[model samples]
Target: MNTDLMINRGIIKYNGNAFEEIDDVIANEYPLTIIVDGDEFATMVCTPDHLDELVIGFLASEGIIRAIEDIAALSINEDRGFAYVELVQKQTMSKDFFSKRFIGSCCGKSRQFYLHNDVKTAKTFMKQIEISVSQCFNLMTKMQEQSTAFQLTGGLHNASLCTKDQVLLSRSDIGRHNALDKIYGYCLKNKLSITDMMIAFSGRISSEVLLKVSKIGVGIVLSKSAPTTLAVNLANDLGITAIGFVRGQSLNVYSHPERIVS
Candidate 1:
């Protein structure tokens, strides 16, 4: 068992009329408090692994920093589950900087952020990128195989940045949003071109998820699960290609089906 990412807990197993006491491995969830330039920012419930990337990604998704260079200094205290980050300029903080909200492992933004923005600020992705239907299935297969954490505990959500051929980066967390943020943060730090990439993840395609992908300027998103009605509408409005229910060789192209080659 990977202790850094999961923990062992005593449990009772029941199979039909048989029962047994045993220890089971479960994904660890910890509250990671992020402090930006000595001010208390927000706390996120996430898997303990990749604290740095989580912080950077969370900030980026919140519109706190635009590039990796914008981060002047960063340090994580695992003992306390806190991340201290300093930005190159204080002006980079969001207009709602002081409004602290407890972000759960499953969701990223607060309800207030969504209510205020109304998806109006989401970038309309105009990139002309086309992928074949076979490529979409292949990418989904790769994402499923690379998600070791989910396979181990069945409690983690996985996300990856991929090209038409392969997955470039992947991350897992208890929250779907955190997983996406980790990938975005990794790309930002490595100076990867997000506009040319697609995001594949193991979760439902919600409007919030679409918003995150749009914020990163990605035009395509693939998911193994279903998509909400609002998410499909948002994808059409944003000019994004959203594919859902990617199982084996089958998938539902909710919006922008023209991008998927036959």
Candidate 2:
């Protein structure tokens, strides 16, 4: 379905001059409530596009569902801010899913209060691709260049998971975390894995970004900015490689420097 809506507004100049009315691009935002097996899960405020992908990705990222086949059916009531997802019979949720809170923070930073010492790695040796500095530059440039919303509003962040061949999924939102979630959702609905995939973002590397990557077992993370201290520590702990300041042919390796050849 076409998700774009149109609005008309007068362009006001910095000099207090108003130009003729023009059509402007507008996306839809609404409250989305997710329901699992007749139980109310969580509600999020998001753009009204890709509802199926959003809910599935949200559950998978939260560790609520392990695989695409685990989801039986999903129905969305766009007018009611609700979605009902029925899981396949006999599937059980991990105990950790009940304890982890659904975070809507722009950075999706994992809460310190919820850190479990017992949490162990769910994946091993996620990526084996040999990447060069120029490849990193091309990826970021492509990710940024594909952000249509950011070009229109100048107020959006973008996230994408790409391969050596092409971009797999890319999303944009007013919040950086939301963009990343959208990309994750896209992957989950499509039954893709973060293993050996490169995640690129147009935001700062915070604990939240690290948590998102860690949850999906993504091997390498590239950002067109800087990372926080906590994010670095988490990346090191999770065996996930992180790269920041990914501009041109240079980047800063905050953790797991071995992943980047040059």
> How high is the lDDT of residue 151 in model 2?
69
* CA RMSD (A), model 2: 5.2
Quote model 1's TM-score: 0.88
RMSD for each model, in Å, please? Answer: 5.2, 5.2
lDDT of 2: 0.70
Tell me the deviation in Å of residue 257 in model 2: 1.2
Give the TM-scores of the predictions, in the order they appear. 0.88, 0.80
Q: After superposition, how far is residue 26 of candidate 2 from its true place, in Å?
A: 4.8
lDDT, each prediction: 0.82, 0.70
Tens-digit lDDT track of model 1 for 132-237:
9899999999999998878889999889989999998888889888888888788788787775789998999998898778877789999999989778877887
Residue pairs clashing in model 2 are: 108-208, 109-208
Segments in model 1 whose C-alpha atoms lie over 4 Å from true places: 91-121
